[model samples]
Target chain A: MEFSSKLLEKAVNEMAQLPGIGKRTALRLVLHLLKQPSEQTHYLSQALTTMRDDVKFCKNCHNISDVEVCEICSNTSRNHKIICVVEDIRDVMAIENTNQFKGIYHVLGGKISPIDGVGPSQLNISTLVSKVKMGVIDEIIFALSSTMEGDTTNFYVYKQLKEFNVKTSTIARGIAVGDELEYADEVTLGRSIVQRVPFEISLKNN
Target chain B: MEFSSKLLEKAVNEMAQLPGIGKRTALRLVLHLLKQPSEQTHYLSQALTTMRDDVKFCKNCHNISDVEVCEICSNTSRNHKIICVVEDIRDVMAIENTNQFKGIYHVLGGKISPIDGVGPSQLNISTLVSKVKMGVIDEIIFALSSTMEGDTTNFYVYKQLKEFNVKTSTIARGIAVGDELEYADEVTLGRSIVQRVPFEISLKNN
Candidate 1:
């Protein structure tokens, strides 16, 4: 017989289904919660059910937000001339934590993974095109994953925005900064070689 | 501004309020739950609510249970004549894992600590005394913490049951079975010396 109640067993099973949480860890969490007072446990239950309720995605940037336009998109202080396009809201938070970029973000929901049947139509493309056509955009920094699908997504977005007079640049995928050449992975070395920049060709005196 | 919603914040707050959990850890847990599917989150919510609703304290031992009598108490295979008293259900679990003892358990709920305002009346002592008086008990072992309060509790219980003719013993407080003498703590060494057996007198070859 289980040490916990069936309800706890069910809850533990659900928690175990989450990314990286196993059944043992789930049991520990349930047991810990059980030791606490009823109000706290009730509050936790309420939050889990109500967290996604009444919450709408930002209509403008596709960031997970309660309002029509995300906070970043609505803020006038943010740079309107540059837009950082990303694959998910998680990336928006990742960039926001850096406190280095003042530009707003546009979430594409996900990349063009053909194996998963995710194509250009599956993403928020019409809105992006409309945003560019409305004119303040000078640069679009594509901060996407280095996966094959992300590259395919970039070309698709690039093709759609080529006519609009905006400079489109994708984040570089070569040897990482501070990496030793001898220990570098083959893929990185090959990409770095393929994307090599040109400078003045020097001839030896000998 | 945080990327989390109000409900998510509430859930994290509830989680952080649990013992040994902090704000950062709660945030990580909330994020993990958010990334999971709705079915999994629903199960976790149901579990939190049911933990209090379904699980009840076992009347026999005060261990957590869904039934009136816990599995251990109801089991006929267990030795009814011996009872091992403990502070909490966790202690019972620790002892059960050993599979060395076949006796029943009596949980004190908590030790007597005047500083915390916990006294004899707060514990399930009346039930324990009644069970002892049933004339079936032959041995009563006290497996408690080595703290001052635990000792005081042990002394009080021992005094209360002095009238009954039963084998009363405490779990040994000495250098542990696998401990290295060089690394033994002073308190453990002192206890071992005081409780020294007649090994030298009885087993001496000379």
Candidate 2:
């Protein structure tokens, strides 16, 4: 047996399955959790369960939210005409942390990666396009990462929504190659948004 | 305010407080849990509360167990005459993983660290001394780490148990410098237990 206790070993094995956590690291976490106060363990268990049970995808933008529409999408104060499109909800959180973007969000779930078999059809592209067709969307901002797949996805998205009569943009300025929006400091990301360009020219430069 | 969602941010912050898990790692874990079906979260939450609420310290040996006396302490196959003393329950779990020793365990709860204000009185050393005097215990093994403070605590335990006529031994000779028993692989550790020397010579030489 890799571990003596069945329950403890199970916990460690489960932990090791997580990204970036190896068997040894998983063992350390399980052992540490075993030593923690009962209250702390209880809190963790509650949090883990509640995270999924209490949260649901926002109907409009597909962002993980507690309510059906999500607070941002429901709020009339948010500029619904301007939609920020991102790879995942993590990007939405990253943009929200900056507190500069007054617009609501639409999470694409993932970027287009042909090698990995993640195509535009697999993502929330149709939802985004359909949202744009609502006619009130004056600007659809592409906030995808600077990776190759990100660029490919942005190009496809721009092409798919060109028939619509509105300005489609992307957050391009100041971001470097192979960078994620989640890791960029608030100041740089905020400045990048301020200098966002239209999809027609932004596609070549980005 | 660093997080867009207050509840999620609170949960991530709490997870980040765990050993080896930082902010980014915590966010990853929270997000991973959020993606899973609610059942997985329920399992984790239930396990946390059950581990805390169902398990209590064994009054006799101080080892964590489900019942009054731990499985190890209550077992007739295990040598009741020998008690392996350790700083925490993790040490017990480590030694148990080796399956080399049949003796019971005694958790000190903590070590003798004056800097952290952990003196001998704070530990369950008195209960250990009482066990030695009871004549049922034929041998007492110190299975703590090889660090300076671990050595100091071992010395303190030795002086207290010195008056007892029973054979006083310690599990050493297999571990290296700055290594905790919990981190040591099972094979090397099992070999170490077979090669433990007498407490007096072992503690002084190291």
Q: Which candidate is the best by TM-score?
A: 2
RMSD of 2: 7.8
Alpha-carbon RMSD, each predicted model = 8.0, 7.8
lDDT for B67 in candidate 2 is 65
Clashing pairs in 2: A45-B45
- lDDT for each candidate structure: 0.78, 0.79
DockQ for model 2?
0.30
- What are the runs in model 2 whose C-alpha is more than 4 Å off? A1-18, A21-37, A74-78, A112-122, A173-206, B2-4, B115-117, B173-206
* Model 1 chain A weakest 10-residue run by lDDT: A197-206
Native contact fraction (fnat) of model 2: 0.32
Highest DockQ model number: 1
Docking class of 2: acceptable
List model 1 lDDT by residue over A1-206, tens digit each.
24524565676776667545677767667667766677777887787677645555788888877667878888999897888999886688788987868988888988888897788898987799899998779899999997788888988898899898899887667776678899988998998899775544212211
What lDDT, from 0 to 1, does candidate 1 have? 0.78
